[model samples]
Target: MVGQAQAVAAPRHHEQSHLRGLVEVAGASVLWGTGGLALQLIREHEPMSPITISAWRMATAAVVLLLALLALRRGPELVHLARTRPRQLLVVGVGTAAYQGFYFVSVTQVGVAVSTVVSLGLAPVLLTVVESVRQRRAPTPGRLAVLATALLGLVLVSVAGHASSTGPDPVLGVVLAVASGTTYALTALAGGSISRETSPLVLTSGMTLVGAAVLLPLLAVVDGPRVSADPVALAWLAYLGVLTMALAYVLLYSGLRVVAPSTAVTASLVEPVTAAVVAAVVLSESLGPAAVAGIVLVLLAVAGLGRPSAAAGPVLPDPGR
Candidate 1:
């Protein structure tokens, strides 16, 4: 009886791994959610150019990733990947920069609430569309329904919310948010393929380096390449690079090891939730009824998106069994 009880209490390997994946991904989400607030705080305290922040974010993240790889004795592998997979690495890097750049600008424009909602909220759907196209099939009816619902929610939030008093121009903000989502979707596509070929750390590190290269000139042109030496500003940049960029990806890759791909993506929905909550509490940004409804609709669609469609046929018991 004791042995049976112990066996029953212990989770099977798959179940245990899945649970751990959930926890790891959830931790990543929380860290990512802190992103909006972090950026806002940086903007307030650091008051540097947007491009400068973007350049530093990617550059520092790349450096930190390199250091990590060196410590782990994978520096050679990282270099080999950069040399061999230059094009793929470039795509990931540019996409990373574009998404981050767009998101930060969107946050400035519309406050964390709307940017988080539109940018993060829209990525899954965009990814779904891209995947469906890549598979050379139209999205199933369920997917279409989810997309429609999510689109409606996006429109609702965009049209209904009042301009945040301290936020940037809503028109430009919404555009930037959508662009951010688009870039994120594209990045995931490229990053996913690259990640399959190499470890996540190396892929992220390479991409960040490439991203830094691509953003360097842009940063110079955007705000004349300014970086503050204030300890407080450095502190924020460090948190952004080390925690949000580097550590978050480490957790993400760790979670991906044990989680089903779709399930992992679904779990990432927590990021938007975290960002929204943090924005509300820390930034005093409030969503109106329509915006709240939009968020719910988008989340519902995301949940649906994560579920495998049963359009083909139901599973049947084996004849031999």
Candidate 2:
């Protein structure tokens, strides 16, 4: 009876844990959705360049996360990570800065909705392909269908958003967005490998610290350092750093620790949807019928990925842990 009760409780616990991870990733995506708007708004008040914003975002997040670790008495753990896993930290850190820097530059060339959709929408597709290659098998039909639906949705959103965009250079923006997505996929794959064995807080703190170290130097090469004195711009910068970079990434690493990288990226499909709606409402960026349909399709793809299916193969425990 005792063994049977334990068996029954175990699956239930796993289900609940997975549900929590999904929620955490979803929350992170929502927070990230607001980032483009924040960056745009920040620039409206200050002439700080994209690299400047990216650098400050990383620096601020690093400071906040490191402080949190100290408060939690986990500062030594962060040091241990730095001492033991410097390579992983550097890969994820540099990758994080590169993707974000690419994304913010894309936002400048393209409108927020288009940039967000193209950059974020491309990641899951890349990750899916990588996973299929890693497994040495073709993606199951169900997974293929879901990927196709997502790709179709991403196309609709991109085309519709671009058609109505007033940005200076849509083509250039798209190229940068693609670069961002590629870097994002690589970072997720690297980070996912270690997240399960490391505390999310410690990992995030280390990554942000390393990211800041990488970006701060680039600030000088790009445009020299520019500080914004405007209170409003400062507030937006704070929000971008704290809510989007620090907190959102903590949630993301937490989810990555539990879910497959492909599933985690698919869940983040929510980011573009959230960005589109916010841009339409706040920035007066209009979304046409096709874009709305795309949003619905993306949501459906996310849902489909979350549901367990036979074609997805047997649930294998993460070897990383």
Candidate 3:
């Protein structure tokens, strides 16, 4: 009776952990989806380069997270991470900064859906290829099929009238979006490599600070400070920095504690979905039937990324920075 009772309790606890993981990952995704909308709001209020917004978003997040580290009495851990894993942290920070700059600039050029979908959708595929190379084996048939489908979806999105009349040049925009995806893949890989040793919160906080440090020169030299005093824009920037950067990442690392990495990736797919729906409804951006079809295909391909890994357990990494 005792043995049976213990077994039952173990499964029950596992189930609860899985449920909690779902909520955290989903919440993170939802919050992340809001970033593009927030940036749009800022662009509405003032005309500034997206790089400027990216710099400030990271800078503000770095300050908030640093203060948070001090408040939590984990300042020493942060220092330790910087000293020991400085190289890894550099990769994380640069990858973080690069992806955001590329994604945001692409967003302004291509509008939300094309930029968001293409950039987010390609990361998993690129990761898959790199993984296949590392393993010295061809990708499994399922993964190959999924990767092919995703590539097709990307092509369809490009051909299906991605450029808005007022949007940036489409050819250049798609190229940047691809670059953004590559950077995101690298960031995810860097995050996963260091995932075991550090507190997710501390690691994330450190990355933000490093990213800010790296980008500060560019922001100061080229962009200068364009922060607006309008309460409305300030409010949105606060949300992007606080909620999207700080809180979303915290929730991600928290969820990663209990959940499998693959599950987290699947849950976070809600971001592009949320972006597409919100953009269509709120921004009055019309996606043609082909684009809609392409979006669905991309979603399907992304779903393929969540399938259980043979031994490595799903490579879809990154606590979604």
Candidate 4:
């Protein structure tokens, strides 16, 4: 009787853990979605260059993460990353920094909804290709079909969004958004390797610090003397540094402990959707029928990727984690 009782409790415990992880992952996605809204607010006031905003965001995130690491006495773990995974760490750092810098610039030029849709909608396809190449196997026909559909959807979204826009250079915006997606793909690939050896918190903190260091000189050279913006803008920036970038990773990493990596990645497709909804509600951005269809197609593509495949090999590790 006791054995059966214990067995019954075991499943409950596992279910509880899974539920907690799902909640954490959902929270992380929420934080990430808020980042898009925050960036939109930041762009409205004084025109701080995207490079400048990126530099400051990195610097601020590094400080917050570093302090948390120190408080936890995990400074040695971060130092060990430099010694053991120097090259990988550097690549991750640079890729992460470039992704942020370019993404901010792209969002500023193209508006958050279109920029996020293009960048994130295309990231899974890039990841699928990278995983196939890394494993020395070809992606299955189903995966390819999904990729083609997603790409077509992305094109539709971009065309629909651009047809009505008059604010910035559409060509330049597309280039920057694509660049952001490429760097984001690289960062995701790098994170897969790092998460195998290091704690996600340690790796994330170290990379944020390294990225901030790389961006510091550019901040000074490009933005000139930094001046304090309005209190509201600063508050949003603080929310971004603390909640979106730093705490979001913590939640994501914790969630990955219980959830399948593929599920976690697919769940985060919510971030872009959240951004779109927020943009529509807040900015009164109109989405035509084609754009709405594109969004659904992109979501379906992500859902297809979320399923584990024998041909796709092992799931890629969660970069946001």
Best by lDDT: 2
RMSD of each: 6.7, 3.0, 4.9, 5.2
Residue pairs whose backbone atoms clash in candidate 3: none
TM-score to native of every candidate shown: 0.72, 0.88, 0.76, 0.75
lDDT by residue for model 3 (18-128), tens: 566557766888888777788889878866567877777888888899898999999999999989999999998898888888887776677755776678767766666
Backbone clashes, each candidate: 1, 0, 0, 0
Better of 2 and 3 by TM-score: 2
Q: At residue 19, give the lDDT of candidate 4.
A: 55
Which ranking of candidates, highest TM-score first? 2, 3, 4, 1
Give the alpha-carbon lDDT of every model: 0.68, 0.81, 0.71, 0.69
Error of 4 at 236 (Å): 0.3
Residue 281 CA displacement from its true place in model 1, Å: 3.2
For model 2, residues 183-266, the per-residue Cα lDDT tens digits are 999999888887877988999999998899989888667763478789999999999899999999999998877677777887
Stronger candidate by lDDT (1 vs 4): 4
lDDT of 4 by residue, 142-162 (tens): 766656666666656556655
Model 2: pairs clashing at backbone N, Cα or C within 3 Å = none
